[model samples]
Target: MTGAFDGLKVVVHVFGKVHDAGDGQGMLCRLDLEGLELVATQHRVEAGASPRTVRFPLRTTEISYGGTDDGKLVLKTPEHILYAERDELEPELKRLGLVSLDHVLSRERQLLGGRRRKGLAVWVAVLAGCIALAFGALWLADWAVARAVDLTPAPWEVQLGQAVLDGQTWDEVTDPEVIEPVGKITERLMAEAGEHPYDFRFKVVRDPQVNAFALPGGGVVIYTGLLENADTPEELAGVLGHEVQHVLWRHSLRGLYDRLKWHVLVAMVLGDISGAQELLLAQAAGLMQLSYGRGMEREADRRGVELLVRAKIDPQGLHDFFGKLSEQEGTPESLTLLSTHPSSRERQEYLKELIEENSGARYQPLDVDWEGLQEKLKGGAGIER
Candidate 1:
């Protein structure tokens, strides 16, 4: 994205009569790279009209091209009124850091009558190419981050997970009755699961919101609201298995990766791994609000059902749990981010088909008094550790 534009010229005008200042409709302006300014000259119009030269320093001068800076009209500025007609001048000005990309966007918004949502595609364009990578290496950095993210080590990932937890609120459940059952079930599922590098930790959060989330480093949080909604041991196991599968598949890590802005990702990739961890820690509270992508969510569902089957728990639990959640009117505003996962109805249907297709596999109920335990949990009674 780097180039030399020493003599780039644009023929432009100012409000000499109609808008800004003095004389001509258009004049040739050269972006002087050396002086860090724009200099344009006007020759005598008639016999004795005065010749004029306009200079705007890069620092003090602000540029308004009406739209994104790459190809735009330099219509508004403070010291002089000038317009540049050439397409090549503005990009060079942007490339040289003389013109502010932020200012360019602000002007575009102003011209659109402050319509925020209308020209979003244009916003994405400005953000994607010229703004972030002013020096032109943004794509290389994207490629680098994409490639380097996988090579990040497991311990570092655990630290990233810890960072995730450090930012969010957690109401750790202490009742042995609640705590022990969760552990036992998780152990059963893990026994059934294949090899994994994560040392999983499951915690019951006393939140009344009906949601569960997975974080890097095998961190799983289940809200009490979800437990209260489940009528059977299979229902509990259904959602639990889904979250655990997210950990196994490294979905937590990928979620963090996806939320990162391009420049931020580039910085973290170029900097140390801990810098990335610090970035993750800073954003940990929002991790729950980060929804796993549709494909990732669907994969978790598929793997979740398989884990249930292998563990002798009924695979239908996954289907039943999702089916029930999707039946709700609208997801709560608090749980909006996590609850409204992509294609809920479709996901539930897919889970049902998975169960029906695998019906030949032997299935057995969980050997636990799940209902009695739920009642005890509701009553705020618990077995001690």
Candidate 2:
């Protein structure tokens, strides 16, 4: 979607004067994100005056909804109130990396509002049921969250993930020499992972922590430290397969939805697409900080192993990666990345079981120069290895 909206323009209605140019009243105008201003020619231009233009600094501007059908975007600047149809302005704002008017308003309201609560009777009933059977309510909650994940549209998930990605600052690794091989592994795994809605993207970043995470849609970020730790291309493939499964299964989105279930429920009940986007965007950073439950981790592991086996790549690579992390758990090399994905003995045993289940499958090493690739990355990319 990069550069997809260059020179994009939208029609707006100006409600105030542009300097000395006319009263501006209901003047039809054009606005583009690039120029960060609105301009009008001939609509309200005085005979000798230049085109009526108003500078629109996004940071100071307030965005809300008003006018016919509640589709008009009311952008309030100190000097003027500019209105445009939401349909006309939203895409351009997204292209320019600006939140939509709905999101802007939602965010402001969310900040000013206190936490919402359920009815006391509902809570009492739920609590009584939970007290009757300890895990029953938990199971029901998971079921509801899963259903919510299913109900969430694919495009919205893509937007949520892309918004999260756009909101971050990364020491990204851009060298194709380093990135090309990782891309190949991701592509190979994805081919066997089956058809899906996401247009998967793999990004490598220069971070010392041995970590990799996937956003809700299809954005996966691989830290250089994880690459440094990968003893073989297959190990990297294992990691990529795991992260990809998180997206495919909507684990990140599920986890997020579970944490903010009330907010999400309200948005869904209200049928507010922009409200949902705003909630997710406001919590973008938390996506990285989420730790999956054991069930979710197990599902990702199972699906990732299935991907490897289907691709005829050894599942033992994944098993071995887990084994290594398990051994290093209490050492100085122990990382908080492991805090989210604790490489427990149980997890190792589970991966081993998966590999044994696929023992009859033919296994082959990934076709990559592992040592040479490591050599290429060793002195560069701030590789600690």
Q: Candidate 2 residues 1-385, lDDT tens each?
A: 2244335554443233222223455566656444444443334566788766665666567766666646576777666677676676655565455444446766744543422233456788888887877665556556656667777899989988888888778878776668778877877888897889999988888877888889988999888888888898898898888888999999998888788666666666676646655766677779979999899899999999999999888877888887888788866444756877778888988998888888799977787766766676676843221
TM-scores of the models, in the given order? 0.60, 0.62
Worst ten-residue run, lDDT, model 2?
13-22
Instruction: Give stretches of model 1 more than 4 Å off.
Output: 1-145, 166-169, 268-274, 331-343, 382-385
Please report how far candidate 1 places residue 146 from its true position, in Å: 4.0
Residue pairs clashing in model 1 are 12-83, 13-83, 14-81, 15-19, 15-20, 15-21, 16-21, 16-22
* Tens-digit per-residue lDDT, 134-173, candidate 1: 6556566555455446756778777777766666666667
Which residue ranges in model 2 land beyond 4 Å of their true spot? Answer: 1-143, 265-277, 382-385
Top-scoring candidate (TM-score): 2
Report lDDT (CA) for all predictions.
Answer: 0.66, 0.73
